[model samples]
Target: MLLSIDWIFIIEKCILIAVIIGISLVVAMYETWAERKVAAIMQDRRGPNRAGVFGILQPMADGLKLFMKEEIIPNLSNRFLFVLGPGLAMLTAMMTSAVVPWSSHLDIKGRMVSLQVADINIGILYIFGVVSMGVYGIMIGGWASNNKFSLLAAVRGASQIISYELAMGLSFIALLMLTGTLSLRTIVEQQQDHLYNFIYQPLGFFIFLICAFAECNRTPFDLSEAENELNFGYHQEYSSMKLGFYLFAEYVNMFISSAVMATLFFGGYDIPFVNDISFGQQHGQNVLAILQGLSLFVKVGVFIFFFMWVRWTIPRFRYDQLMRLGWKILIPLALINMLATGFIILLRNNGWHL
Candidate 1:
């Protein structure tokens, strides 16, 4: 059995998982710094310059502060569930990254090394199921806090997630009809040569983008975290690193959602308008792989920026407005988008020409 083991393959996959997880943690940490820098620039003020050369080490400082804070628990809170809540939220957030194709395969000494952790056939379904479970984190945390405010925020968050997920799934159904496969790797490979899904599914992309905001509870849609009414929202009672986990989970979710969006609509890891295979032939395979990975991160970066920009630029939505947008506007538009995509696919099957 030892002789038959594919040591190289196992090691390569292990390295990939470790690298991906490390990158996620580091990026999520830095995103806080970036958010502040972006906000400061937009407001014409300096931000976080005291910690380390323009606050490059700000995230680490924040982590240290949280770690050093006094751990606090309310007298009436459920001890077990209160702690479990943030951990569950973080676990679900990190789990979504496993299905995403980070980059093209690497040619490693007569073997191929894939960057993805697990490429199940029902990849999209797995994503949907796991992401839906993320609501439990906030719900449990809020309910266990034994605070009316936290409980209310949890209720609103769960409802908002349920409402928007419907539209989000409908939007993806249109893309599924186009690709006819749930494998994210297949989707990326299909769009290898200047054929991004966004070009074909613009309406679907828009619907998905909006639903993504609602799903992630980003601003304009962060009704759950509305400080004025909810008094610091669901994690209001959490302290120290426990509270840090909740905030960190949000950034992690944003990063993973950005990656998912890039993989679905954008040509994941494919250099736009450039033939990657041809470029690899010109350059070396390793060089090409590095470039493709960089391309994916660039797309993710733009999306992350968009998330922060919207947070600062757009005003938060009222509770009623948030519900109306999801149920009344987004769901109807998603239905239309799905219907249109089906009609186009039908016409194409019937040999209808453009």
Candidate 2:
């Protein structure tokens, strides 16, 4: 019986992993389609409707093109690391998904199946670590390419991520104080019972949101790939599927970052104005699980749209301006937010709790 149970557990987890990873890829694919449609709408032109209805098949077509394109390796490049670069970039982007709780557990035949891949105690830190490591993809590829422009782009990307991650970590300190736990599950649960983090940590959320954009290398902070200056930047010499891997990784990062924001600030999978935790106990767990999961994705979709919107709306920031914003503006704001949160928590603890 124990062996049977263990096999069942393994199967359940395998299914969940496949579903989440598949969903991430599918969402990433459509985000490219949506981005073009959004850009077309903004520019008052028809978007990609030629391939399939409303360009639904455009991503597949693009993928096929990438696969069919002639693979190129610059004669001077480090062949192994050149290959490792995109793979590493793609790996780091997907790694962040392991800790995200997609929804409350579903009750299946008296066994609870968790929607998350992993419930690591230090989920947020895991996300931070993986995201920080993503720059290595660009760095490795650029250095391997034996191209000066690519190397420059890699350095810019590395510097930009490092600068923003500092403020990002500082921003989270305020929320961490309120939740008092590093676990993403705990954070989500606390929000379900109490108020969402954003309600109390608006300033922290603002700082985090901006840093997230910077972390994902979105416009207004995408100086790393500034075309005119860097000549297509890191991966400039990459071709075919390798280039596709780099582009695909960006969209994946954006998707995961959006999901992270949704989980942290938007109450994750908690259904609003309802006691979903209690409702699950009284009602059917399966239904509640689905609804809660849907709620989380709804929030994620909104964030993704917001990301694309900002890309079309905002101009890219100059390198100096980007560094100044991170160091001078965002870091100071995050520090202040953290300090204030600590003071408030102390006050509430010492006879100030209502």
Candidate 3:
């Protein structure tokens, strides 16, 4: 029975999962430093340069501070749900990475190993489902706090996410119309041989990007956390590592969202203007895989920078404006884009048939 089990595959997957989790955590950590640095540059001030060379160690210091801080649970709060909120948020954030193809497959010894944790057929759907659950964390935490402000912030967050998700899903439907596959790995593979989806689905990508901003609770859609309105927002009652978990989850979600956007719209791990397969044949699979992984990371980095840039540059939207944009504007645009994509695909298919 032991011999029948593919131990090598299991071990490979385990290692991949651990590496991915580590990478996600590290990226999330540095994103805080990057955010501050970017803000300082935009504001013409020094950020966190005191700690370890241009503030590179600032995130570590911040983590240590959070760890040392007292863990406080509000007296009136529901203890079980209060603890569960941040845990659920962090879990959902990490879970999204399971389906993301980090790079092309790497050949280990004689066997080919995929970089993705679970390249399930319903990869995109899995992401949507996980993201949908993330809102529950906010709601539970806020309601458990037994604070009216926290409950209001949670309500705002849940509504914002729900509103934008409709447009985001609709935008994805247009991409699905083009790709005809739900598998993210397959989408990237297709793009390797052709133009990236962004070129073909520009409108869809635009809608998706805007919806992505809203989904991540980034400004100009960050009404839920508007300091003037909600104080500290849904996680207001959390302290110590529990509060850190909520903060970390947001950054992790941003990183994963960047990766997902890169994979969907850009040629994920596909070296631009380079025939990866031929290059791999000329060089070796390991070298090619490393380059591919770097390529994906580079794209992800650019997207993350863009996210930070917009957050610093833009102002938060009014609650009414956010709802209007999501329901009235984005949804209609997404619907039209989806219809147009279908029409174009139908025409092309008929032309090919003729």
Taking the tens digit of each residue's C-alpha lDDT, what string does model 2 give over 1-110?
44546777788889998898899999999999999999999999999999989988999999999999999999999999999999999999998999999998988899
How far residue 302's Cα lies from its native spot in candidate 3, in Å, is 0.4
Prediction 1 TM-score vs. true = 0.97
The C-alpha local distance difference test score for the whole of candidate 2 amounts to 0.92
In angstroms, give how far residue 85 of model 1 lies from its true place. 0.4
Error of 3 at 290 (Å): 0.5
| Model 1: per-residue Cα lDDT over 1-354, one tens digit each | 548887877887789888998999999999999999999998899988988899999999999999999999999999999999999999998999999999887787857788899899999988999889989999999999999999999999989999999999999899999999999999999988547999999989998888889888899888888887657889999999999999999999999999999999998888988888889999978889899999999999999999999988999998899899999999999999999989988998999985
User: Which has the greatest TM-score?
Assistant: 3
Query: Can you give the lDDT of residue 40 in candidate 1?
Result: 96
Candidate 3, residues 167-258, lDDT tens digits: the string is 99999899998999999999999999989999999999899899889888887887767777558899888899999998899899999999
Q: Report lDDT (Cα) of residue 311, candidate 3.
A: 94
Cα RMSDs of all predictions? 1.6, 1.9, 1.6
Model 1 regions more than 4 Å off: 1-8
Candidate 3 positional error at 311, Å: 0.7
Error of 1 at 38 (Å): 0.7
State in Å the error of residue 50, model 1: 1.0
Cα error, residue 308 of model 2, in Å, equals: 0.5
